[model samples]
Target: MSMINTEVSDFSVQAYVDDTFKEITKAQLLGKWNVFFFYPADFTFVCPTELEDLQDHYEQLKEIGCEIYAISCDTEYVHKAWHDHSEAIAKVTYPMIGDPTHQLARAFQVLIEADGVAERGTFIIDPDGKIVSYEVSSGSVGRNAEELLRKVEACQFVRKHGSEVCPANWKPGSKTLRPGIDLVGKL
Candidate 1:
């Protein structure tokens, strides 16, 4: 069940942002690059390290017009508590979404029903509210913010230059392959 290019459904959830609770809806995800970082839980090992790394790159991501949301099955209250207690989580300035009812987790297909948690899922969505890219991994493994940023940049570049396609490890200035029109559907 690949969710690629699937338009996000309309829904709203409470998010902890900048010392306050806010509602984040599908409408908010429109007209900009967005990243949905789904982790297992708050105050857990590995998750904090990943969140801190993401916080380190938050400014650069925003500079490129991308918004990030850290989501888990925890409640907004728990998210705030974690932010207040954990030094790593303390540095996060992006929206931290609480999906205790698993609405988001289920929609993202990252839910672990038995454990009442989510897998480590990272999704890159375009302004159209469609998922352009996604990756899921074991809870023990952490993701790299630098790589995620690169992917977002690449997605943006491709969106702007529809004829160009990014290659592996592609950066902004890197060369991209422009498939010949005759060869477009062969692969």
Candidate 2:
């Protein structure tokens, strides 16, 4: 089933963030854009690269009113340990959510039940708590943060301008397609 426009369900999970441990809930995600980034496991090869990539662009995402949450099936302690041990992970400043119970993973439909991990998934949710866009990649592949930033920018632009739609490879300040007006001549 398509996850588009699906409201995020109520959930509270432990997260390691800002050099501390805290509880993050669905309620907190409301009133702001959120990126629920799920990875296979903590301390893995590709996961850190992706997280670090996101970290590099973290400020840009926040400047546009978006918050990123990196999640994995590993426990919070493991996440903290990885943060303490790895140089790449040490640079991540966003919330590292611990989905040990697989509640969040199952809700997002990215859980790998057989392996006890989540697929590499990226979900962009609006301030209303509904998912606007999502993508799941193969376990062996890593994603690009620059692309994720572009996706968030596009989502925000569409949310602010309901009548317009972003075209392929759309970036901020670029021309957008107005379905009724722009398509009148073009087919």
Candidate 3:
């Protein structure tokens, strides 16, 4: 089944952020847009690059009222160690959630049970805690943060203008379609 518009389940986990360990809860995610980025593990290839890419766009995401949470099955200690050691990961100012118990990985349905790791998953959640958009990629592929920012903008735009829909490659200020019988078969 599609997870679109589905409410996110309640969860509490430890996260490493800004040289401190913090507890994050589902309740905290409410009342604000959220991006839940799930990856395989810590101190591994590809993960740091993807994380740093997201960090590069963090300011723009925050300006759009979105909070980023990068999650993995690794422990909080491991997350902290990687943050301290890796130059790429060190650039991340967002929260790095540790899903050691796999509650989050399982909830997001990105867990690889055999490997005890998460896939490359990105979920865009609305302020009401419902999932607005999501993408899951193979471990070998990396995601683009700019594309994610565009998606968030599209979601926000669609939410505000319920009658219009974003078209392919739609960027902010670009034309959006207003679906109607007159528009049918016209594209």
- Per-residue CA lDDT of model 1 for 121-159, tens digit only, reads 999999999999999999999999999999999999999
Which model scores highest in TM-score? 2
RMSD of 3: 1.2
**Which portions of model 2 miss their true places by more than 4 Å?**
none
Q: Each model's number of backbone clashes? A: 0, 0, 0
Candidate 2 per-residue lDDT over residues 1-187, each given as its tens digit: 9999999999999999988999999999999999999999988899999999999999999999999999999988899999999999999999999999999999999999999999999999999999999999999999999999999999999989999999999999999998889988787
TM-score of each: 0.96, 0.98, 0.97
Q: Evaluate residue 120 in candidate 2 and report its C-alpha lDDT on the 0 to 100 scale.
A: 95
lDDT of 3 by residue, 1-187 (tens): 8999999998889999989999999999999999999999999999999999999999999999999999999998999999889999989999999999999999989999999999999999999999999999999999999999999999999999999999999999999998895499987
State the displacement of the C-alpha of residue 139, model 3, in Å, after optimal TM-score superposition: 0.3
The superposed Cα distance between candidate 1 and the true structure at residue 97, in angstroms, equals 0.3
Error of 3 at 166 (Å): 0.3
lDDT per model, in order? 0.96, 0.96, 0.95
In model 3, which runs have C-alpha deviations exceeding 4 angstroms? 181-187
TM-score of 1: 0.96
